[model samples]
Target: MNTTTLTGLELRPLAVPADVSELETPAGHDFATMMDVRNRVYFEISGHHDESMSAAELLPHYQPNPDEIRFMWVAILDGEFVGRAGIDIPLEEGSKTAFWQIELLRKSWGKGVGSAAYELLENKAREHGRTVLQSWASHPAADGVEQIEPPTGFGSIPDDHAAHFYKRHGYSLEQVERNSAFDLRGSFEIVERLLAEATAAAEGYRVVQWEPPTAEEYVAGYAWMKSRMSTDAPSADLEFDEEVWDAERIARHDALWTDAHQFVLVTAAQHIATGELCAFNELVVGKDRAEASHQEDTLVLKEHRGHKLGMLVKCAGLVKWRELVPHSPRVLTYNAEENRPMLDINEAIGFTPIAYGGAWKKVLE
Candidate 1:
């Protein structure tokens, strides 16, 4: 299907190929162009390439998946690609949430391009039975720019172009997230000390580490922890469906990383007495070991809090990650500003705020 606006912008559905080898096809070529535009948007916002993914590494995810449906469209002006947008609808039973994103080159702003694209997105969401739409966008800092703070009172984002656009579209700034980075080449003395203290404090828990394609013994426990992420994490005024996870779900999650040739190190804290995985942390780096690593999904179960398991798993993971991907320059992570405990841990580990983002939401009438 094709959509056009008064601004002479055309929105065409993007086709996903079965594999990267299909790039020789017209659809594959369009997909590649979309990826290029995506990376450019990320770089322009974050001033770094860490968020960039190669076509080969990102293609597998665009293929069919059972858990959700993804639709993408490219923005064309005067027959040249300018940007793209997409919406992901989770297939969980009775879910009303649809996550979406819209991006256009700087030259395309204020031309009614974004408004026209959002019209199509909102219409699609309604067609899919989604009532709540949420999105997060980086609101990079700028001198003299006003800031919008979430009711949580933890972080604030500059009222930049994205903020104005979202507000005009009937979305409210619901939460703010902090983007942080840790220098890997810096000293690890503090990491070593924290690991020791946490290990000593976590009396009945032991640190366990492994790579993706989770081991057989830990799959169930891992699945339980994964499920808890939706509930356990600090989400201010935002809604997430309660996810059900199992061995099959774990496999699907692992393949998205392993199949992309990305290296993932899982550091988990296991209750030695019951052999239950109480807490975990994940460190990931793409095919290029020299680039920045990503810290993904660190959680210490609510029932197991106060044992310092959070610090134990995180520090242990970092120490191991350094040995495994020593060439990686640094590690990057994001957390809600209201999540004080996690932020404390990050700050103590020498991570500092590099940017802030706003989490916005709008409900359909």
Candidate 2:
């Protein structure tokens, strides 16, 4: 696809380095400058205290992966970076959707830069055979809704801000999600109590914690449980497909995190008699920012319901994360509004609403 041109502005692919050390090269310099622009806009719009990705933190994303292809582009005017955009295409069979996103500096928002960049992104997605494009935008709760104050260091945008933007671009809101966070330093007693109850309820299941490069014995079972996330998680009315995962794919995912120096803390509940993995949860902490961690996935197999295994694994994982990354103060997670079970668990454990976001989709003819 050819690059798009808009009055003194040009949209071109931005080259990211494979190795963190090579960021000083000419191509890498452009990449770094582009990220700086993105970070500035993100922080300004979200009002979040989270720091932008460092060179080391950003290198792994550029690494080649067989399962997905990513394209990054920069919008430049008069030799200055004005905005950036990206499109991610999944190579898995039956997956015909591309995730697209574009961000422009606050000062450049009213201009034609965003439109030009998005046009280029759409062309690229179509060239790759994607028939549907999806994107997510965050905003505060709408009027007449109970307003929940976000936790310290977090922020939310006005509800109409992103809604109007996407609507103008032909995307429809499919689902709304509540962004929640747990201040790890607030209170450990509730988590301790939940842990005790879950432990008693899950009598025959034992919890196992491990770092990345998951154990060989649990690799197959782990992959199986991970694959279920796509089908098990609530997607509301959005059109989505289940993902296929195997032992090989799991290993490849582990390598991506390892190369980026990120830490993955996993806790799984194993059925004592059957020796089968039934439930699991994961906590991820970027090496550059140990002050905050992300709650990735927490799923309990169908047969394991009512055992409180979800709470068990989550509590165990959080405790393990504290031991591994003691400096981390908060953990962030997002859950669909209709997912009451998980929401109940999170609320009981002290997670509060931080923001709201909508998943938007556009089907191309």
Query: Which one wins on lDDT?
Result: 1
RMSD of each: 1.0, 4.1
lDDT of 1 at 312: 92
Which 10 residues in a row give candidate 1 its minimum summed lDDT? 1-10
Tens-digit lDDT track for model 2 on 65-136? Answer: 788899988888767888788899888787888998888787777677777877887888889888889987
Tens-place lDDT digits, model 1, residues 214-297: 999999999999999999999999999999999999999999888889999999999998999999999999888898999999
Runs in model 1 lying further than 4 Å from the true structure: none
Q: Evaluate residue 140 in candidate 2 and report its C-alpha lDDT on the 0 to 100 scale.
A: 53
Evaluate residue 169 in candidate 2 and report its C-alpha lDDT on the 0 to 100 scale.
82
Candidate number achieving the greatest TM-score relative to the actual structure: 1
Clashing pairs in model 2?
A: none
Q: After superposition, how far is residue 80 of candidate 2 from its true place, in Å?
A: 2.1
Error of 1 at 294 (Å): 0.7
